[model samples]
Target: MTTARDREILRLAVPAFLALVAEPMFLLADAAIVGHLGTLPLAGLGIAAAVLQTVIGLCVFLAYGTTAGVARHLGAGDLRGAIAQGVDGLWLAVLIGAAVTVVGVPLAGPVVRLFGASADVADPATTYLRIALLGTTPLLLMLAATGVLRGLQDTRTPLVVAVGGNALNVVLNLLLVYPAGLGIAGSALGSVLAQVASAAAFVVVVVRAARRHGAALRPDLPGIRAASRAGAPLVVRTITLRAAILVTTYAVTVGAVADDQEVDLATHQLAMTLWTFLAFALDAIAIAAQALTGRLLGAGDVTGTRETTDRMVRWGAWSGVVTGVLLAAASPWLGRLFTGDDAVRDLLVPVLIVAALGQPVAGVVFVLDGVLIGAGDGRYLARAGLVTLVAYAPVALALAALSAGLVAIWVAFCTVFMGARLVVLVHRARGDAWLVTGVVRAPK
Candidate 1:
């Protein structure tokens, strides 16, 4: 028999999974459209996308933090407070997004240059990045708004908006890239416009909820400060995580260039893109874990929290196994969809297999990460992220230093890096430290 908890988990996870997959579809669509342009353009898109994702990834605290805060308030029977907290988070997003755009636009060229990519690759990368930075504000706005809705236990809205936005992005890219003849810049412009539309839709929905619940829509200075305070540890945590990825990317670039193997760089790009897609897909359960853990803790239901955590862990592991099997089966033909280069496609196969083998570990890490986040255990998470990064960095750098192949690089990341994360998270989850039950998390 399906218990009420199981039903709720399904209700949230199903839509959340769709929404998460849709989020990565934006990148996949971009890769597909841009790949046909030329090797240089595709390579350029890889560099630009890495920089863009890093920025967005760093700001993810807006979503995770807001989700926990809003869900806790909602569970505590304070709908108005939940909406108000979300409003403050939205305001923070606007400020942070604007600031990022102002700084990022001017540095696009220099940042891409930092990768030491050839001029042919750097030129298009700078072009795409400069245009894409214009959409940062709206992108962050969407993140904060999605957090609000998720906290309200309405993942379906995000799924609808994300799917619609992805469809629009693809259509616009097709029209602009070829028919309109804007080249790679056209792809960037299309993505920006789609993001703007999604952000607007989210804003409307969040504002309606706020008005209906009589929550003030104006920016609350103290509230914003509080949100910032709560999100500080998460920002550190995300920074460390992003740092690890950036280091891995840097390793790939350096190793490829050192070995005079340009195909390796492109192959790593494709592998990373696919890995991100899988990560988000598996994160659907994590999304459910985040919302449920926060709400359950807020209601002071300790047993329910423990039971739900265990169930979600199982769901995450099984989902990873199933996804891994499917990905491994499709690995042979997957690279052809992104690029026509035979070299890149061939190199991608083995790298992806290594990634496939790590899915179960990835699933558990993502879920436990979400569970702790939902419980507002940001401080420990922050420390753990740093520790994981510290342990993994040397091994990755050593591989790069030896000029090991791309497959070796990915093996280190998937096994050494991911394995380290799994260990720390498992240790934390096995303890009672994160089981604090109340509206506000108790200090450790």
Candidate 2:
């Protein structure tokens, strides 16, 4: 017998899951379409895609900040304030997006070269990166708008828009890339158009909601400033996390740990792929934590917020356990799906087991992360993120010297990096400092 709380969690998480899935699918579609363009274009696309993802990923705070702020106001019965904050987020997104495009377009060639791409690959990579940067505003707008909807407890709408947008992208890429003979450029154009359409759709929905609630629709400078301030720490937090992953990748590529560099690299990549997929599933619960916790705080219901936290932590733990069990059970077969090389498969098996065992910890960490974010505790999260990175560094460096092979490296990641994060997050979540009531605000 499911309780109301269970139902509420499902309501938010299920749609959020689909929405999250759609985001990666957009990139998957691009890869599939561009993969057939020959090895050079595909290679270029890989580099360009990595750069684009990192750039935009750093701005994910636009959505996270908007969601927390809007949800807080709405929970306090201040619908107008909620709508106004969302508008500010949207405005900030556009401004930042434009700035990124201006700076990135001219330096596209240099940027690709920094990644050590050869001349043959750098040209197309620069071209794709430049073109994709053109859609930055639309992409940011869509992200902020989706955050707004999530804050309003309307995940279904974003899910629908995301699905439709991806579908449109596939059709557009097929038409533009093939018949139009635009090649990789067509793939960029198709993605840009799809982003625009999705942003437009979000605008329409947000406008109607604003009108229905008698809220303001235009941008407000003060609100935008506040949103930007609130998001600054989150941005730092995100960049710090990304740095850790990149450092690990750097270690793998430089043959820092494994004797057989290529085989170890292949195994690490496969394990990371599975790990990332599991993260997507776990993040759905985190999204729920963010939305619900913010609302509870705004309503001045500290007890309710605490209850929600406990419940979410339990949910996260069980979900992680289930995911780990499944991954472990499938470990033997998982390698076959990605590779025919038995050597890679052998290296991947133990690494997958390490990842599987760490899922419960990952689940707990992610949920606490969302809880803090929704509580508008970005300052602590940012500081903690840096601290975690510092702690992980020694462990990571030891791997290079120990030369303990690929499995040992993954063990370090699971126990050291993620383990440190779990400690800080759990401490914060358990404390009352993140239980503030009233409207969510940036630190003075």
lDDT winner: 1
Q: Write the per-residue lDDT of candidate 2 for residues 84-120, one digit (tens) a residue.
A: 7888888999899999988988988888776554576
lDDT of 1: 0.91
Q: What TM-score does model 2 achieve against the real structure?
A: 0.87
lDDT of each: 0.91, 0.82
Considering only N, C-alpha and C atoms within 3 Å, which residue pairs clash in candidate 2?
A: none
For model 1, the superposed segments whose C-alpha errors exceed 4 Å read: 257-261, 441-444
In the order shown, the candidates' Cα RMSDs to the true structure are 1.6, 3.5
How big is the positional error of residue 190 in model 2, measured in Å on the Cα after superposition?
3.3
Top candidate by TM-score:
1
Worst 10 residues of 1 by lDDT: 257-266
